[model samples]
Target: MLCFRFCPVPRLELVLLCLVLGAARSCALELNLTNSEKATCLYAKWQMNFTIHYETTNKTYKTATISDHDNVTYNGSICDDDHNVSKIAVQFGSGFSWIVNFTKQEPNYFIDSISFSYNTEDNITFPGAKDKGIVTVHYSEKVSIPLNDIFRCSSLLTYEENHVVQHYWDVLVQAFVQNGTVSRKEFLCTKDKGSTTVAPIIHTTVPSPTTTPTPKEKPQVGNYSVSNGNTTCLLATMGLQLNITQDKIASVININPNSTGFTGSCQPQTAQLRLNSSIIKYLDFVFAVKNENRFYLKEVNASIYLANGSVFSIANNNLSYWDAPLGSSYMCNKEQTLSVSGTFQINTFNLKVQPFNVTEGKYSTAQECSLDDDTILIPIIVGAGLSGLIIVIVIAYLIGRRKSYAGYQTL
Candidate 1:
């Protein structure tokens, strides 16, 4: 009851792709570039601490910092290899970038120091600032990155008003075929470790037991969020098998639950329920009811195959949530958007899977449904009417007899 909700090829897909490409090619993940080591769990959460020091040429400056930590959920690391990471890089937009340089020691990666920077003439603006000024930022932070299974990628992490609430997990692919590969392309190396070529490596803050307090103000943390135009809280596609044409199969779903990026408990969302089977042809329906955060498809059209390969399509009868009496409506509010991609569902049979995002106008042959409530309702109404009439006639006859008997008693 708690797992069915999900979306389409929107910005979410693009973001995942970017994460894949950037993670595969990012310089900060030196292990990814190392040929001897294999990189797995490339797509996982990285707990980042960002400190932005914005300074101008004329000596005007301010610093702001933010921690990706939310007290409850722990964002994990990058590798499964027992060998610790020697380098960690967190790249910001076009300008700002951060890296923690470390050396690969006997068993663990020894962190030497953390480095980060942002430099721009006029782009870095704070809470209150005049129009034009050059700004330079040197931010340093330490964080942990978690590891994920080979097929799964923790694509998005959302918090409501900066509070970490659970039950909003939406992992994109539960199983991956690894359609792409990561390879180390090129390298620029220096013979001497201390040569001027490694010039950028500099001394950052190495906190000792006792250090004098500095009066510098803490940097302001900025807002970070991920959402679509409709503000879907969380979505995932689970147990989905695709690209089967010859055999009967199970189906796919697109659950677009509505929320401002916050999902918890039973909040049902709009969905495209589809089930495709070689024996059952195809089935598709689009719905936009209220949003619920629980997982599992409330109702799906299914097909039952007999011993002799005979098949029957499931309709209103098999559905617990979608069960409506014969001729009665679906009893749930439908989605208003006429979007072609707004809804989807699946089926069970000899294994075939297909998708239809086109607008559904009327029920086709595959959508033919049946319910026995009306078949029994007609007989019940007639029997009830006849029973009521018979009782009324018997009461009238008894009254007439009483009137007739009153005259005899008077005589």
Candidate 2:
């Protein structure tokens, strides 16, 4: 037996609660729909990547990314009897939902639009935007059609309102299938055939002061990627560190994305990657292409919540690090530090990134960072010095062996 009880909450709240409850029961990463004949099948699998830039109370910019499905609590689908239209809703995180509407015309099914709903009450995620109330990022344009096989798109969809909330979406979806099952062919959206470029490197954070550091422990390298279909568009591998001042005491934070949430978005001209945790509210790195041929890290935005209940914000846009050609990556095997702001410093070790024109799911060519030029020259200089020393030693030895014996009278 099922029991029902009515709460006295506001109508809007009640509706939202019901929707959430429904999603909790049906939330799933994959959705399967069958026609009345039961012989035809429609399958949909999507990986959604969202980049949100919001404002704080002090008029500072803050960014957040929602790409991890671990927080997804609800998923539901509705289709008409004739299967002409289908709607799917996925709710994740706190007060956030994505609704996708699909329409089928004859032999093809097309995505009509996608609507993103976010609640401003979640101060932890939308801190200063509390006064904005409910916000929606909608894309009404029709993407492509013919979902019979695999349909994929990774284009950056930008939506902004009042310069307060800016949303960039990178969606990879495959819906509407008449084949018996999903095909095993490699994804053709990009040159890659998988979602990741290399085996992701997982690094644990450094132990606390009281704990002894392990001798074999290496610094964590954050491997972040944004993919659509089987092709990864943005890939970055680097060890991230944050230097900040707390209570006038300087401290360093080694960002270990292995134990935190990491998300990003990829586009042709620009890309973004963000790391989020309780201690570090959000660390966002933005990359952009310039002069249509070169690409570089354009800026970094962050909001740090300290242990002393104080908040530190970083909004630095005057940065141009790790520059390379559009078809190549930037490599820096040595540690590179940038003063993101007067009070905040960012450090990256063994950094390699390719944000545009990636090929075969890997970096095409590498352009060494200018900062690493000296590092590249150290080996050459040392080798030259060693050769010179060896020649001198050989000459000295020959001279000594060939010298006249001063003490030998028989010579």
Candidate 3:
């Protein structure tokens, strides 16, 4: 039993309490009791979602309902905290409806009467209403009477608005009173008997809902390491080939005229080589706090060496529109790969995408043996040859002069 302290309310508290709450609101739970006749103690742990606006915090019922457990007895000294207790929101014989938690009020209040009432209407509305059937109040408020009436409480607080129905529902909290303080507090709630939905009017019979499973992420392309003998088919499709060992720089992978396997729509074996290297490098490449578009390489400024020792760089070497191929393109999918515009090309030459440092996208260049300004060998050789030729001509000229003089003397 519980005793409630009664006192005069300073405000004109009537009609719907929520109507005067301005922007705030309240509600009561729709309960369905296993045993309505028996006065069994109910325990409930309800969850609510709160919306904080600048100063005020308003709470709303979530999709989940109160987890009701059996046999939770009243606990405390009556009205000790005065945190619980609300006005009669609904009228007597008010059928199944939404429950509401009235905003906490001051002063004090007592329970004059705690009873359950039920009434069924058959206006072609209430579900399972077979020409107005008997729908007993399965769930309702159960206010505990004080074991020891310390206040000698009599003029019980007016059942102001407990019967008034709301669109939502909330748990009802009533406390067992002592002299002035609350000794024990117990929670009560109306069970949802008919539908999972909360409404002013009882909704129709709702079927159990089916849950949807979350989707799994697609696996990114991966790599494999092998020798040339193992990949006879790969060599046929790809014009050029590159191989990189994990963590170690096995060899500088160069793009050549033949690396066209990646230029077509991603087939199982179509783009396998490029797929393998890029994926393996991505795993090894680490940019802890990097964005997808963050630059790895500013400019690919290096001469590429082909298999036959032919060296060349990208003709124009455009970096303005260079997109860091960091993450997989959105069009690239696992099940059915998309057809791309192939690779960069001019005339019949298909441009090769050189293997880059996964993080830096750095490319390597081959040093062609062009004329060097550092060496003086060419100048030295030319100077020696010209001096020798000049000396030979001078000797021949002197010999001719000697021969003419000798001929004159002989005459």
User: lDDT for every model?
Assistant: 0.28, 0.60, 0.25
Cα lDDT tens digits, model 1, 299-369, are 44434321122333443322323322221123112211112211222321111111111113221112112
Q: Where does candidate 1 stray beyond 4 Å?
A: 1-44, 51-85, 122-411
Q: Compute the lDDT of residue 107 as modeled in candidate 3.
A: 39
Distance from true location, Cα of 51 in model 3, Å: 25
Top of the candidates by TM-score: 2
lDDT string, candidate 2, 332-353, tens digits: 8888887887668877888998
Best by lDDT: 2
Question: Can you tell me which runs of candidate 3 are displaced by over 4 Å?
Answer: 1-16, 19-118, 124-128, 137-172, 182-411
Rank list by TM-score: 2, 1, 3
Better of 2 and 3 by lDDT: 2
Give RMSD to native, each candidate.
24.9, 16.8, 29.4
Candidate 2: list runs displaced more than 4 Å: 1-218, 370-411
Shift in Å, residue 287, candidate 1: 64
